[model samples]
Target: MPKMKSVFVCRSCGFESPKWNGRCPNCGEWNTFEEVDALPKSSSSAGKSSARVARSITPLKEVDLSEASEVRYHTGMEELDRVLGGGLVKGSLVLLGGEPGIGKSTLLLQICEHLGKEHTILYVSGEESARQIRLRAERLGVVGDGLYILAESDAQAIADTVSSNKPDIVIIDSIQTMGISEINSAPGSITQVRECTNLFMRLAKSEEIPFFIVGHVNKDGAIAGPKVMEHIVDAVLYFEGDRNLSYRILRAAKNRFGSTNEIGVFDMKDNGLEQVENPSQMLLSGRPTGVSGCCVLCTMEGTRPILAEVQALVTKSGQTSPRRVTTGFDFNRVWMILAVLEKRLGFCYSALDVYVNIIGGLKIQEPAADLPVAMALYSSLTDKPLGDDVIAFGELGLGGEIRSVSHVEQRIAEARRLGFKKCIVPRHAIKSTQKFAGIEVIGVSSLRQAFEAVK
Candidate 1:
């Protein structure tokens, strides 16, 4: 037997040292070093040799393209399928990272349940036992023979199971919890995460099998582990949303086979994750009948248009400096609008505390939401309510001018579908032959013109 040595490793950047220090020299993060025992050189060598033997590589151009049609597998979830560019392609490795209890496991389990009827799926969980997973499946009302579960964390054992089963799809509950015996570091450590991800990548490519690995997010909302882990995967999807809200968003940050701008929306339910086909209806529900601080806005997510409610509150401030707060909307952008309101509209908002919020917990990132945000603030200050049948959205400039927004046609169509009788948009957005039967489109180039038309 060889003697084991101890070393200190930094959790942030995976920097290793023989002695501990107060600050990590590599990542500059304090109190992130931990001691771990090092494995013998012989064991490490054996593991590397085994991995190479299990996986094979070939030139991309030399490989036959005749079997391309058989490489794709449909998971039966339309939203998910869209995000994945139609379906899962064989020999592709996908990484799904999110905050705790963000439904990473639930979404993957649902996919397995739906695809298990036609194809075999092996689900490996390093953090939970078979009985625990069974209970969860029962609660989710999932039952299928083609879906198999394994509750082990050993990398070698998992590889062996994959080789024997040769299933159509494999899902690892999380990659951080799995450990390689050849690595001296504990599970969830940088060394272990890197090695396990490499092994999975090898298995996916060599076996020509599609694999999904769930990942944990750090306190800063970033994917846990070294940055290299993200580079190794073919696709990286971020599952994000406020835990207090039932809605969750799955966005593709990186994709080798599809567009990165695509997103999928799901509502958390007692049974499982339910796809939200018409998100506009849910977002516009429970809107106040006649509110001074409310406005409707059409925003584009990817290629789809959604109608969302914008709310604002303005009141005289007692403090020396008025406070400005915003949720689900940009803070700096709100400040910019305040400046415009004070200068262009001749409004005295400097003495008032302003707050803004987007209804249904949806975050607005596009400039198309700018007009509604400004109108909501103005309506609150003036105590004037906007009409229920009117919808407004456009970008605001420093000169108090309205700018054209992308996908204007889709926005108008969505508003028309929701029974909105009037729409205030940029002049450049209106087409020549574009006319709705019952709805009217008002085009404006300046903020003053928009306010006069809406009033």
Candidate 2:
């Protein structure tokens, strides 16, 4: 028998250290070191594994690529399928994370209803009892003979059940509660999460089973557990939306099989998550007919063009320093736009409390939103209303020039489909050879021209 030694690990980066420190030397994160027991290595098992392993490696060209045609399992949710790069690939490990009460469990359970009809699913819940799962399943109207529920938290026991049952797909309600008995640390610790995920990864790869692991988010909105946990998975999907709002957006933070730019939008309802097929129409619904400080912008999400409303409020400041508040839009970008407006267009903003918001809780990350933001700010400051029939999308430079944006034709087409009569784009965006119908495209060379055209 050997005595176990205590070691500290950084919760952020999974860096192991023999002693504790204020900051991790590997990742430079402070107050993240958690002390855990380090078990002695089993040399007998290690030797056995090494002895059974093959020393020869096959050449890359000699490997057969026929296995790439393995069929994917569709969740029956088009939005989810889009974010997952068409559908869930076989033998892939996906980590779905979100804040509490953000519908992480609801989404998974809902998918089982569709997947259970065609494939066997092993849904292991560590957080809730079997009865609780059944109640929720009944509430969601999910019924299937192929959906197997096991309310267990022991990792080794779950693995044994998986090996015996051999389901086509598996869903771990969450990874935090499951723990291996061999490890002395409590469940959800860094060691438990890492080891448990490693076990599931091996199970998925070796057995050709697709695994969906539900993960909880930390205070920083990152997937809970060490950062290495995210690196171990094939894909990472984050569910994001305000609790007060009925809509939830599913985004892929990392994907090995598909594009990370794609997003899935769902309207959370009492029944379940209802997919928004035409997100543009849903976002633009209930928009004020004619309003100042509001402007619609065409932004691209992956290959899909989306229309978002940029709203700004400019008012005289009553305090010593005028406030700058923004939601769903970059704060620094708002400041830069104000500075550019003041420096180039001679708009006095030093004493104005400027507030900017993106309607529908959609965060505009692209630089192409600059022109709409500027136009919205100008409209608000001047108390001039830009009619709802106009759409704007272009990038603005410090020199006040509108920079050309990509997919201008696509944006214009989307605007037209949404019944917008006019579009304000960059001068260079519209080439002499290009043409569009059903909407008037006004090309602007600078911010001044854009403001004049909008008014």
User: What C-alpha lDDT do the candidate models reach, one value each?
Assistant: 0.84, 0.88
Q: What is the lDDT of candidate 2?
A: 0.88
TM-score of 2: 0.90
RMSD of each: 4.8, 3.3
lDDT of 1 at 114: 78
Query: How displaced is residue 127 in candidate 1, in Å?
Result: 1.6
lDDT of candidate 2 at residue 403, scale 0 to 100: 97
Runs of candidate 1 with Cα error greater than 4 angstroms are 1-70, 220-228
> What is the per-residue lDDT of model 1 for residues 1-455, given as tens digits with 9 covering 90 to 100?
55668787666555779999778798787777766555345333435555444566899997787866447788878888778877888889999888779999999888877799889999999989989888888878789568999998998799889999899889998898899896766788766776788788888888988999998876541234434367778998889898998999888878898888778899999999999998898889889978898999999888889899999999999989998989999999999988987888898898899999999888889988889898899889988997888899999998888999888878888999999998999987787577767689998888888888778
Q: Give the TM-score of candidate 1.
A: 0.86
lDDT of 2 by residue, 1-455 (tens): 56668898777666788999888899787787887666335411222455655698999998776857666899989999999999999999999988778998889999999999999999999999999999988888889568999999999999999999999999997898889998877888877887788888888887889999988865541233535478778999999998899999999989999999999999998888889988899898989876899999999999899998989999999999999999988999999999999999999989999999999999989999999999999999999988889899999999999999999999999999999998999999897666788888999999999988976
Error of 1 at 421 (Å): 1.6
Looking at model 1, which ten-residue stretch has the lowest summed lDDT?
219-228
